[model samples]
Target: MLREVVTTRYVTPLREGGSLPAIVEADDLGMYVVKFRGAGQGHKALIAELVSGELGRGLGLAVPELVTVQLDEAIAKGEPDQEIQELLLASVGRNLGMDYLPGSLGFDPVAFPVDSEQAGRIVWFDALIGNVDRSWRNPNLLRWHGRLYLIDHGATLIFQHNWPRDAGALEKSARKAVNLEDHVLARFAPDLRAADAQLAPMVTSEAVDAATALIPDEWLVGEPGFDSPDDVRRAFRDWFAARVRAPRSDWLPELAR
Candidate 1:
């Protein structure tokens, strides 16, 4: 869990990020880049981002540390989540985690510190859940301390239920199919780890319940989190175990188990 403010003040926004993520200081906690969720997707993307970033780090990848912090309306824009916005405003501070990727450079293939081999590791994870956020133009990767780390996954694993039924011509597909380049498919192609399977269980009934507690009640007034975190967990499980693993890929099954 994280708070809104601490001993230090929010210096300013990190101008480099397209998503407009801000950089703030915490006397005891250090620096963090916080991103707010808005109209296009939802706050669930932020949750997914936290989960994926944390899980990747757990897998021994050089991902930045994750933290949660609340964003003020002055810095937050385009967020249609009145409930979350109000929540962020109310409790002085909320649990918006941060992933410290200091000295890390933004997305760039040629300048990337990672070898072509490890590229597949990330691609494999993205493909499993249709993460299209990390792309050539905006690869959400950074190089820090000579290690390549991923970030800003607030665009992956979009919930199908969120898609608008009347969003005519805007109907989107589920997080089942992902587009990967030939080289990416070549590397981890042979052994795409069960990133989804390994990550899904941690987002369990109990975990969701706990997370729901952190989220403001207004945001969860009738949300699946407040009513039944298990429902949200089940949505993730149904997607991962059913479609994400529908393919007979070894990595999928290995993770599924």
Candidate 2:
């Protein structure tokens, strides 16, 4: 029932792999990426967007705003470009939403020139989700106004599906490994990285509250949660902390581990 503000004017495919996202316009607004039917992951991908993006913002990372959309199967079929039209006709009835990235340009962290301290922070977030996009190969990061933005988190939490029995173990592994990235603080050291383990507690109540505050309850559709998104956030924090502090912990160092 959430109507997307953006309308499809044109959809330029980004690449060959994963969801073939398209560039779209939002009623005279700037451009954004509209993800039509991401091939083969599952509904869990939406969960990542909801949880990770919310959690990242809670951690003070800059993330794009999310808008629930309903793509008209006709948009693809209506394409003026015959080639594109045919492609859409073949793949109809896909759900779509816009990813807003204003005045942004993709850049590798090294190219954008962030210091090791900040790099460690980005690495820390990635480690939590076992995010696979930030490697030297894909490095799906962007830069704008001299700041960094993390993007493309479609392939995370997958360890959950593959290793269901060890879900708790995997979460713990992510938390503890965060401490191993001294390279992040090498130049900045304890000052910048002080919040490493300290973040576990905050992620609980405050972060979830922040995210759910922005999200409407109706969308959740009776998903299990604490009293508030903040409460759910606390669940994540407590769970993460307990795992990290577990003896002979499974956590790997946060970055450069």
Candidate 3:
């Protein structure tokens, strides 16, 4: 389970994101960018944020520390915005939060050049999860303290959004080809071959299990065709494991090699 913290104050809404994730102070005295459960994306977005972010962290990527935030609807009483007030009320329970990075600049390929090795690893990790949001127009990356940090993984692991009744769907999705033409790091000509050799072996069954284990039970509830949250977790674990074992051609961008 993630370390739980209570929201002490709601700072302000980050209007940049469609889901309206906001900056808030937690009881831990640490500021976090919280993704509310009541947001348009729903609980599954929080699930993706936790699972994908943890998976990236496990893969030795620079991802923000994630925490489970306990929100009290009373905090909304001071908010003047009706929309934000309603969102707070709807998200009265558990939500997801990422440690806030102060004054981090949005990643710019020209301003901060990324080496092929690091780019390869990031590109490979994104491909592994079928992330579609890390495009050039909106990289979802931040440059903080001279290091790049990945954020906002709610857009990845799209397969979970439409749980297929077919038992073989997981295996098939694992082998689907990914288009990397628009990936922000594609310009770096990432050596995905080297990235694959160095990183793929590390995504063991144990690692996949560890990543999925971080997801809260409530986030996995009500998933169709699954009897319990553990079942949903098992599905995610199996999918990642299969993707790792799949032929490189299926997922790795040919140009990246």
Candidate 4:
């Protein structure tokens, strides 16, 4: 389970993406970028953030520490921004929080070049999770202290959104070809095959289980076709295990040499 912290104050709103996550101070005296369950993308987005973010960290990628933040309704009472206040009021409960990276700069391809191996691994990871948000136009990446950190995984594992329509969607998504032409790292990802060889074997069932274990029960509740949160966790683990064990070299997009 993720460490839980209570929000001490609502500092400011981060209006970067559609979700409008905010900078908040926690009782632990740590600052975090809080992703509210009340956001437009909802709880499923938070689930994706937890699952994919942890999985990336397990793969040796840089990911900020994550925690569950408890928000009190009283925090919204003094907010003058009507929209922000409404968002805060609606999110008065458990929310998702990422340790804030101060002085981090948004990734820029020209300004900061990435090595081929790292690029390939990042692309492969994104493909495995069916992430569609890491494009050049809005690369959800940050550079801090000369290391790249993955962030904003709320748009990943999109097949979960289709559960109400088709429970088999995850299988199809896992097998689908990833279009990487617009991926922020695609231009520098020289060896997708090599990346598969190096990273695929690392995604074991135990690793998958550890990552899925971080998801909160509240976020897993009310999921369609699942009797309990454990059931939902099982489904997620199964999907990820299949994706990792199955050969996905064919699913990788061709990268320019």
lDDT of 4 by residue, 1-257 (tens): 79999999899899976989999999999999999999899999999999999989999999999999999988877788999999889888999999999999999999999889899889988888888789999999999998999999998887678652244665565676667678998778557778888888888778888988888888888987789988887777777766775556646677746
TM-score leader: 3
TM-score of every prediction relative to native: 0.65, 0.68, 0.96, 0.94
| TM-score-based ranking | 3, 4, 2, 1
In angstroms, the error of model 3 at 257 is 8.5
lDDT of 3 by residue, 60-92 (tens): 899999999999868976678999999999899
Off by over 4 Å in 3: none
Cα displacement (Å) at residue 245, model 4? 3.5
Count of backbone collisions in candidate 2: 12
TM-score of 2: 0.68
Stretches of candidate 1 exceeding 4 Å from the true structure = 1-7, 15-19, 37-41, 70-92, 160-175, 182-221, 224-226, 248-257
**In candidate 4, how many Å is residue 205 off?**
1.8
Alpha carbon RMSD to native, model 2:
5.7
- Please report, as a residue range, the 10-residue window in candidate 2 with the lowest summed lDDT: 183-192
Clashing pairs in 1: 4-93, 65-99, 67-97, 67-98, 68-96, 68-97, 69-96, 69-97
Scored against the true structure, residue 53 in model 3 reaches a CA lDDT of 93
Q: Candidate 2, which segments miss by more than 4 Å at Cα?
A: 1-3, 80-98, 159-195, 209-249, 254-257
